[model samples]
Target: MTQKYRSRARNLLHLGSTQANENFNQMVSSKAPKARHYGGSSSLMNRVSATVLQKNEGHSYLAKDLESIPDPIKLQNFNDFVTFDLETTGFGYCDITQIAASVGSSKYQSYVYPRCQISVEATKVTGMSHSIATNKLYLHGKEVQGKCIRTALLDFIDFLKEKDQPILVGHNIASFDVPILSRLLKEFGLHREFVRIVPAYIDTLKVARKVFSKEEVNGCYKQCNLVEVYLNIKYDAHVAVEDVNSLQQLFTVKLKDKCTDEDVYSITCKSCKESYTDVIKNKIVSKVICEKLSKDGIALQHLQLANRRDPNGLRVILREHGVPFKKCEDLARKIQEE
Candidate 1:
């Protein structure tokens, strides 16, 4: 454990899980959806202070042994962001029903009309049926699951493009929602360009741990369950609006404190597997990274699969390709904007 995280862990212990979370709900999570709406970056924007939310920190008592945690970013820049969640019909790389996004109190909810029978595990959790999703969900045959879902997404993008911008949000979005949705969108040939400003995506569960639950629990394990976060914040479970609402609450509560992106970025690195975080935090640098990847004889298009971000990931590729980090960072942004 480094001195920084050790200090963080110690502070988290005193906050006690529940109180710490509520503070975050009130401070940080609150500003997210609206922030993404304006084309900023990240779900939350501010500096991070462990003491701001937690009175005492929790640690595993050692720093080196603490490398297994999936460090999530306590993102800010709520100036332009969206709060989104999905009630999937199945888990892990499968189609889902109920995809909901919210900007402040206003929300966008739609159900996908499944082409096949709903998965049993999914059925157990969400109680959604093929019939119910098809017959009852809002976008059954429109632009989305039907025309309605599709239209909502289209309108959502247009709204995002217009000053609002898209910052796709949901629980565990990076692992399942993003990869699956991006594939689905491209497969269907849907036009999903985001707002003029580059979109900065966030996952509420990740935000919760980064801001509220700073204890020494395994970040990867903690992130796997959204219910854990809800319960910790003293919020109700199993309801889409309520869960997203809780996340929003979490976002607002913890962010009012002063914290930097570097803090969140470092914490996130401890949990998730990625090579370069510098790119994850900077869009222009990431753009430079894409260029470096191409120069290295790597497949640029394939590397961008689903916009799965990591400045260091691309940077490592460049390093292997003998490209200078500063050169890639400086040039890629220019290329991307042009």
Candidate 2:
């Protein structure tokens, strides 16, 4: 017996440590604690499965599961989807040069003469420019007759009224297009008519992020890139009409079945009034900083309150959440000015 005990002790010393076993046991204990008896219940199996999922996938598994859960409300038909896109003069306080929307075989496109100059960069990309001398709009160096923004908006609202409260979907619309459109609607005193026709809107960029794995999308969710990745064809981009067409195709092929009505954000939802992403959209801070702030669950209102209470403390908190010191200072300064 003494000789056998000595041999077992030597073998134990040669074997690796039991740290992995200890961790798994700890996880199981956390899931099914001894304080509550679960061994005889069916929930024990679920607890064990959850423990295994956590052990293999980490905490992100919970978020993935939540995202996959079906929403209680579903759209009656997919045919009601109206995909749209816009071409603008510039980022903030910009004018919309083009508006386009499509539902099935029906389509709408209009050019609006802007009250401001189209930036040279925008002109280069959109190939739209206005000649104040001629009082005319030109696309690709050809003269094109266009309507004033007020008239153009009224026309667009009329186009929307043809459908019965259509679900408006656009790429990056939540962060970019919707805000611009909302401002213009209010400015033109057409907010009530626009919202009355459009009950909800979906940001396909957000849907793509939720539906596709990061690896599947190759870590880039740009509209052009997504069209190429999913549709396997490249179309003329930057033109609002062509953009909407391509987006409609992308949605039909990839996202039609994956989306639910609950994914649609209400046009009149008070909570949608402001978002943390607006900081990035409004150019108050770099995209990287705003993304980190969102991941840290910080909202714009919270940041505003924090700034009002303890501006320096907000910077420290932002820095602790991985925002660079210079970016933190810039964001603080921008928020203060706001």
TM-score versus the correct structure, for each prediction = 0.47, 0.58
**What residue runs in model 2 are displaced by over 4 Å at the alpha carbon?**
1-79, 269-338
- What digit string (tens of lDDT, one per residue) describes model 2 on residues 1-338? 78866655632332234675688899999989989999989999999878766765567667643232111123663347899988988888998899999988899999887767899999999999986544578899997767777788899888888886587889988778887887777655566568657756778988898998889779999889898887788987899999999999999899878886546665543322346556667777776555445433355665676777788867876676667888888888888889
lDDT of 1: 0.45
> lDDT winner among the candidates?
2
Candidate 1, residue 62: the lDDT equals 31
For all candidates, the clash counts are 76, 0
Tens digit of per-residue lDDT, candidate 1, span 1-338: 48766645532332223553576555444444344452454423332232222212222213322222121223454354565666655756565466666667676665555444567667655656554322433322233333233454465455455444345455666555655555444333342233123234555555555665445334443432434443365543434555566665545554325334432222121112233344445543454444334322243332342124654454444455445767755544433443
Q: How does candidate 2 score on lDDT?
A: 0.75
Of the candidates shown, which would achieve the greatest TM-score relative to the real structure?
2
Error of 2 at 284 (Å): 25
